[model samples]
Target chain A: MKFNNRNVHLGMNVRLGNNVRIGDNTTIYDNVAIGDNTIIANDCVIGEPSWEYYRHGENYTQPETVIGASALIRSHTILYAGSSFGENFTTGHRVTIRENCRFGRDCQVGTLTNIQGDVTFGDYCKMHSNVLIAEFSTIGNHVFIYPFTVFTNDTHPPSNHYKGPTIGDYSVITVHCIILPAVKIGTHCLVGANSVVNKDLPDFSFAVGSPAKIMRDVRELGGGGLYPWVYNFERGMPWQGIGFDVWSQQQ
Target chain B: MKFNNRNVHLGMNVRLGNNVRIGDNTTIYDNVAIGDNTIIANDCVIGEPSWEYYRHGENYTQPETVIGASALIRSHTILYAGSSFGENFTTGHRVTIRENCRFGRDCQVGTLTNIQGDVTFGDYCKMHSNVLIAEFSTIGNHVFIYPFTVFTNDTHPPSNHYKGPTIGDYSVITVHCIILPAVKIGTHCLVGANSVVNKDLPDFSFAVGSPAKIMRDVRELGGGGLYPWVYNFERGMPWQGIGFDVWSQQQ
Candidate 1:
């Protein structure tokens, strides 16, 4: 369909609230629900087709997708069936939240990030660009995931095999890091950049290196150093946004 | 730096053309050049601090970034130092084009995709979301790089060290595919999803499996079969800026 056409082929089960502005070339399919003040950007596809696993052919169930009020989903994003976002959540472009995933309120998911199926993100979580949170993962409040990080769903993943994985909450996964499947990261933990996490991380700790060793304790890094000396130029000086002179000196 | 502040900075050495629109909170640093009809969405970081790369002590060089005419870079994307785009090039959200890469006309780089330095993409290339293209690579015309694909710079990379890789034109690098560096992909090639390629691909061949083998020649798949039925779907529908019903299949 053309870009500004919203009233096309919508399902009867779809519901949208007031001030909900959708962008060009967006498709909101059947069986979707969105709340008020939720602005969706251009070229997004909500409620795409999905498959359900069945031991027998007759037993299959497809789930519904939902989004809460004031949530901002940007352009080219795909929200599959059985996926959802909570209130005041803001995501950068092209984020793919897979089926059966749930995100809590005020979550800032970065662009090009993928939160796989059966994953749950807690409130106020901020994830940077190019992060991959695999299936069955659990993310806690105020968790931060940096750019170019990856989380796997299977430790022994054969090529062309599909398996499930899991993770814990309140953790910070740093840049270019990789986490193996079924390894649970505890709450308030920190994972350093370029590390390969093959084991479970303990709570309130800092982990680094390949196979990710737990290095310094959390208290040593001062509460895991969520806010470091390097002011995130990303958050402060956005594209076309203004700068703070106070923080510019530190850079 | 607040998001909506108006006293934004566009550097003096930057060259901007007509109809080049920038979004809020974006910073285009000095010595940058942007072309006409380029639309950059919100919260993007265009230029870097300087052209100086640190290698131990002394050697440093600086180069400016250039965005060509009709290039559309979406929100939260970063075009780092010495990157350039050709006409009608588009990229998805939170994407990062690292240093010293260039694109030809009508290229589409997907959301959260990361293109490392010294790469070249030819005309009408399309890349899906969350892909990683490492340094010193080359892409040909009408190429399609799928989502979650990764290209490494070296075959036997000195574990965590940098290496250079390359790809030829008109190749299809499928989803979740990883290419080890120093490996060259030939022209008109098709790489299957989730395959790890460690060697060079022959021209007009379809390679698949781990350490990808040449499964079929392109001439074989091009024959009139069930494959021909699927190729029509591979041609994505165009987005004409109008109302619906002219393009909707339902109508």
Candidate 2:
């Protein structure tokens, strides 16, 4: 609905729901379904053909891509084929999401962030600007990744081995941190900025510094670092103006 | 110079040198000049009117933007007004360069890079993907900034103060490092990955760790940390297959 459609190119079998606004010069490729009230900004490429298109040029077949209701894709963003997002998915400007990525409801990816192929994120995850997620990353619900935080998939790069770090629910990874390959971070953990996570972190841990050491439980930090930050913080979240428990019961 | 001019908006008094190739859907505003053999890729916005455009919309007047010969601007780049670059300048995908930025000859900026306004770079400067250069950053010649490295101009953010880092010649800032406001790094320095630079570093220093410590002289690290790396490494540089001494002498 209300789509200007100037210079917009849509391939065969593309479906858009009600009240959708597609901006100028946007391209939505074949076999992509976007749900209601979605706003795709200018110069965006949805359901891009990825590597097959690179190798075969114009002769490549398209893969099925799906986005649930109320998605907001920003300008110049590129979303490759075979990715699925639940309702209320949003992204910042010039973000790149590679093939086969999956995200649950109410996920927000910030500007210039890169998500490599086969990444999975649970509900209510947030990633800030310039974040890098390597292939095969598994992130649980309510995960918050700050700016320039990187998740690696290779222990020794240029080798065949690939095992991305697995982050448990309600964890927060701060800015400039590098999570080593295959590291396991438990729920309710807080990773300090610029830290190098080389080993597994336990639940509710507050890790800081290079080769991060657990300082204390995250809940120990008053005025901040509360358990399930969703309960404490409510600036722009869905439960804003209402308690998280109250909001969840209604849901 | 041949221009197809499809869906391209050209403002008044725009100048182009010979052998220039501008891709589709590009917008070049007024008072701009591009040099010979420059290739600006698709969906680029050259001389974007920035803050005035936001306040005034279509009534905004653009400032003068100039680029020298053989520049390659890749896809979806937005270069604001009043920026100038010397010859052999290139950029990667989705770069956002703000107003009043200046770059010398043979500069290569990588993908998803964000260069804030009033930044200056000397000759042969290379910044890899996902780099962030804040306002007032002054970088000297032959600097290599790796991925996700950031420079901040604010000592205390959200305040009135501003002082960006000044990097001397032949410095290497590695991945995921954060250069704090007003930091002065001397020539032939090596800032290791994941470092946080808060103070001034003398010449030939090799700094590492958060609140970076000067570990050793840069020349001490073999196979790397060499002064004027242009002489030691020459795979893709203009001096490739020829020694830097020979190349400089010939020049």
Candidate 3:
């Protein structure tokens, strides 16, 4: 393992596997475990205290962050305390994964993406650049989210109760889509660009526009044929193919 | 030039003009040049390799990133190889500009904005937070793009053909507007918030709604009078406006 500077702080009981690289000024707190071949870039803050607090100035307990094998966390990314990631977790620059976030294997998060506290993602979930997944969101496997998509959790201002949306498996959300609080998007659904998803979506539905309505089914337009790249991730070869495949897939 | 640590790598033949201040953990690669009085914040990776490659495993040649005078690059921003900028390039946090991107003088890119490879922007172009400019996009001078705007480059999936939209000078794209590929947005046009731009817009037109159509001429509502802040950028003071100019532009 290579440490670019001695100023890098590794707290008590922190375990790092073989060939792990921690860059300059990176601070990993206590009880954090990073698996093998994981590269944590410069100035990243891992296992920071959570932002959950009570109205009376009390704070919630902070938990440990566990990163699985072959994870590549880029520079300036912040992983709040209590976050856990599966194997082959990769993120672009300035990504923020908040406290109590759980991710499955081979999930790729793009640059400037923020997953707020209590978010859960299944395997091979890819999010494009500048995406915001609010707290308590649950995403199933093979879900693809395009750029500037926002999953909002709050309905009323200053409300104590906040519930995020639940996305089913193989759902594709295009660019600049906004998913309202507590919305349930079913599997194999496609939400077009600039859509505002307010209600629930059925399986294999194609929805578009603000307050998005179902336009057609994926099976009607030849299912799985429109998105050949989704098959690559399903087959565990997430990084294969040309510019359309690699660059377009939030990697 | 102020280096936070001596371990910061300043590559060979890198010309840094006077009063250039680079923050901690910043790596400026070889052949990169920064003009006088530029401030690059922490954890920025300047002049990294481009994300372009051929089908036969051959990668595109990396190019130098040139920053003009009096620029301010905030934290966690990554400028890929083959990018060039004119004077006074001010950007918010975590902006990523890919390879072969070109920018003119006094351009302000807001936080979490990503300009994909081969994009071009003219002088006094101001893009708000979380904007995505896809590959081959061309933007003219004095263009103001609001938050969550996306310029798409691809129409059909799995096809090799890619083309981006061309936004003309003095145009204002309001928040959450999506410009589809190959569309031409004319000069002095105004696209309303959350509009989906699927076709071409004429000069001085005001467009709104999905599959954006021209509603009226911008000159009908008094040209340049509606946006007083555009004149502020034309002058030297980008941030010298009052509350109406600063707060209303975002909120």
Q: Give the DockQ (C-alpha) for candidate 1.
A: 0.02
lDDT for predicted candidate 2 compared with the true structure: 0.85
On residues A57-148, what C-alpha lDDT tens digit does candidate 1 reach at each position? 23544467789999888886777778888898788987877788888888888886777678888776788987877666777666788987
Residue pairs with clashing backbones, model 3? B63-B82
Report the alpha-carbon TM-score of model 2 versus the true structure. Answer: 0.68
DockQ of each: 0.02, 0.09, 0.31
Number of backbone-clashing residue pairs for each candidate, in the order shown: 16, 0, 1
Ten consecutive residues with minimal summed lDDT in candidate 2 chain A?
A152-161
Put down candidate 2 lDDT per residue, B1-251, tens digits, no spaces: 01346678878998989978786678888899999988786678999888888899778777899989988887678898899999989886788899999999999887788999999999888886788999999999888886788999999878999999999987888778899999999997888768999999999888988889999886676645344455566644667788777887997
In order, candidate lDDTs are 0.69, 0.85, 0.80
- Which tens-of-lDDT digit does each residue in A1-251 have in candidate 3? 12346468987778999978897668997779999988787668898775453332344554678999988887678998788999999887778888889999999998888888899999888887788999999999878898888999888857988999999987888888899999999987888888899999998888988789888876656554664335433334354555335644685
| Top-TM-score candidate index | 3
Where in model 1 is the C-alpha error above 4 Å?
A: A1-112, A115-251, B1-7, B49-62, B159-163, B222-251
- Calculate candidate 1's fnat: 0.00
In the predicted model 2, the residue pairs found to clash are: none
Give the CAPRI rating of model 1.
Answer: incorrect
Using lDDT as the measure, the top candidate is 2
lDDT at residue B83 of model 3 (Cα atoms): 91
